[model samples]
Target: MDVAIIGHSLLGGPDPAPAAPRADAVHNRRKILDAAARIVADEGPEALTMNAVARASGVGVGTVYRRFGDVAQLFAALLDERERQFQTAFMAGPPPLGPGAPPGERLRAFLHAMVDRVVEQRELLLAGESASPVGHYDHDAHLARHTHVTMLVRLLRPSADAALTAHLLLAPTAAGLITHLTLGRGRSPQQLKDGLDTLLDGVLSG
Candidate 1:
């Protein structure tokens, strides 16, 4: 048996190798992403030009492009990172659950905590509208909401078709809907909590 070891350069093709990022380049990329988030939250989605992100991050325009290709790529990356953070907080970070609470109570706490994040990050949440091409909803946030809904089902386990219950919960608990109700229409936090309680009661009353 002849085993040919493909060299690193030969493994892909003769195409231009992606240059390894320098320490400064890596730092610049982080800065650009952070700055983009800050600016988009403070201003609006329309404010997230590559030039503006570079200026805000103190990186050259070329650096921004090199790190993120273009505005769409940059926005996608930023939203992805934010989505991961939200997931981490709910699943692993110090929160209403703290990783050891009973499943039923954890489900309730997760709902409350999720609403709090939506309210606290209202502007950032709004900027996430571009998460979809139609600019109508944040796909990442939707995915997260589905994740939350699934967790609720796993925790609640009321024998009413867990998957369907997850879907029902997801529709109303999605980030966009929550934002529209709480931040946009001035729904009180307690009111939102009560709604969740009612939702859970209906689901688990069996």
Candidate 2:
């Protein structure tokens, strides 16, 4: 591992203290991902080509490729970042869970929190449709989904198929679905939130 990371430094001494990531490299990477996200949002996932991302980010094509390897890799990296953000928001963010509020309210707040994140990450998700054949990017998403469903199931009545019902409840409110319903068909966020409340009410009425 040391050899892989530091090459000759491993022979010299303990990998030479690991240089910090260059500021320009970090900035360019962020810029590329941001540009890719914006392009996806503006023109759809199909627009997220490496060349286009490089142009949009004002970085060279080589720079984009070096940062991301390819369009699929870039999308995967972006989704991975989104997954981390979502995890932090739902599990560790302000209020409810962070403040020791009631379980039910925490659950509701979690749902809303998930909704907000899904909405924000819609573009990355769309771009990720054709992401790497390996599917590592999806690992975090799958984990989050199961973790969320498990939490919801614990709060739900025993009669409900917790996992199935969780999926049903969340599917419509998922980023892809919500985007289609809202942007594609002109539905408002309030309308969707109301429907979400109704769904949750039915599920939790017990």
lDDT of 1 by residue, 1-206 (tens): 00111111111323366788789878887899889988877887788899999889999999789888998888777766666666666666564554566666667777777677767666665555534434333344454455556666765675557666776765565567887887679998779988987887766655
- Measured with C-alpha atoms, the lDDT of residue 30 in candidate 1 is 87
Go through the candidates in order and give each one's C-alpha lDDT.
Answer: 0.67, 0.66
Model 2 RMSD in angstroms: 8.1
Give lDDT for model 1. Answer: 0.67
Locate the minimum summed-lDDT window of 10 residues in model 1.
1-10
In order of appearance, the predictions have TM-scores of 0.75, 0.74
Query: Mind giving the per-residue lDDT tens digits that candidate 2 earns over 1-206?
Result: 11122122211223255588899988998899888878887887778899999899999999888878988788777666666555555555676733356556666666676666657667666445434433532454554555565565566666667767766766665556777887898987777777777777776776
